[model samples]
Target: MSHYYDEHDLSRFGDMGRNAPDLWDKFNDWYQATFQEGSLTGREKALIALGVAHALQCPYCIDAWSQECLEKGSNLDQMTEAVHIAAAIRGGAALVHGVQMRKRNAQLSM
Candidate 1:
């Protein structure tokens, strides 16, 4: 089954009515104005977006960013490297929290 959603649809899949279009539009406009020229080309930003999407664990965003990254000339190896970086960060985050869990367990006896 397929449902249609436009900017006005505002379904809460992820980025929905949480932000007003007026505000979102302004933010997006500013982003374009700030990063779409002079420095940090669209291709560079696409790779960054891909890395961020991986970190955020958003499948939809990941799909979009990966496509954009490829279109923007990021090779397969670069894309895979970005994903690996995200994986390492996520794993390190989980592993680092083990210290807190162990500490809490140790203190429970006291």
Candidate 2:
């Protein structure tokens, strides 16, 4: 079945370079540097990217990172765990903000 987001869009990601070569070059450089071997292994970085992509709700990133994680040798369990970690952090952040709402409610009631 077709969806609003075509899988083909992923292939067109680099087309942005056509309009703005300088910014695109900088972005590409940053992206390449980010994925290079740092303190984290490539597989670990892929897993982290998968988690952040899921949390950000970017379908393109999610799709790309899912494949990347697999290609980087992350197993299903590890990828799933990374997604779950993102979910937990997102949930906790939402819940924590409720404290401010609760405090405002108390002040308004008084």
Candidate 3:
């Protein structure tokens, strides 16, 4: 069966640079700079990236950040917790949109 998200496609990510070299270079530089050790340690950043990867629902990012988390000394427990955090935020964000629905319903009822 053919799947939409091929794991092998992750390897071809660099090919994006071929089409837009300048833009890709800028993005690469920014991405590299964002991951550098600073106020937050590399491990902390990796955990955050993993959480965001889950939130964004990007399989490639999820896979990459999972490995990044592990390599940065994050344990399964930590990674799982990060995923849960992302889940909670995503769920809450969706639930909060109910306010808009409620307003629309009220307008229609009037």
Candidate 4:
């Protein structure tokens, strides 16, 4: 099926650099540094990326990080838990926004 987001297009993510090289170079440098093995192991970082990918609902990132997680040595269980953590944080953020609704309702009632 032809979807709006083509899987092949993921490979072209850097194509924007053709138009603006400086911004692209800065972004690429940041990305490379961010993924380096630092305080967190590469596997741990991949799992975190997988979780954020799900939270952001980016198909390309999900696909890429799923493979990266495996290649970095994180197992299914670890990745699954990472996704759950993202879900919990996302759900909590949504729930917290309800406080605004509650405050507005109280003002209207008064």
Which candidate ranks first by TM-score, i.e. highest? 2
Model 4, 1-110: lDDT tens per residue?
A: 66699999899998989999999999999999999999999888999999999999999999999999999888899999999999999999999999999999999995
Flag clash pairs in model 3.
none
lDDT of 1 by residue, 1-110 (tens): 26553433323443642568777777767866864745788887787778878999776678778888888888999998888888898899999999999999999976
Ranking by lDDT: 3, 2, 4, 1
TM-score of each: 0.69, 0.94, 0.92, 0.92
lDDT of 3: 0.97
The reply for model 1, stretches above 4 Å from the true place, is 1-19, 34-41
Indicate the residue-level lDDT of 106 in model 1.
Answer: 98
Better of 1 and 2 by TM-score: 2
Off by over 4 Å in 3: none
C-alpha RMSD by candidate, in order: 4.9, 2.0, 1.6, 1.6
Candidate 1 residue 107 Cα shift, in angstroms, is 1.5
lDDT of each: 0.77, 0.95, 0.97, 0.95
CA displacement after TM-score superposition, residue 29 of candidate 2 (Å): 0.6
The number of clashing residue pairs in each candidate reads 0, 0, 0, 0
- Residue 108 of model 4, lDDT score: 95
Better of 1 and 4 by lDDT: 4
How far out, in Å, is residue 108 in model 3?
2.2
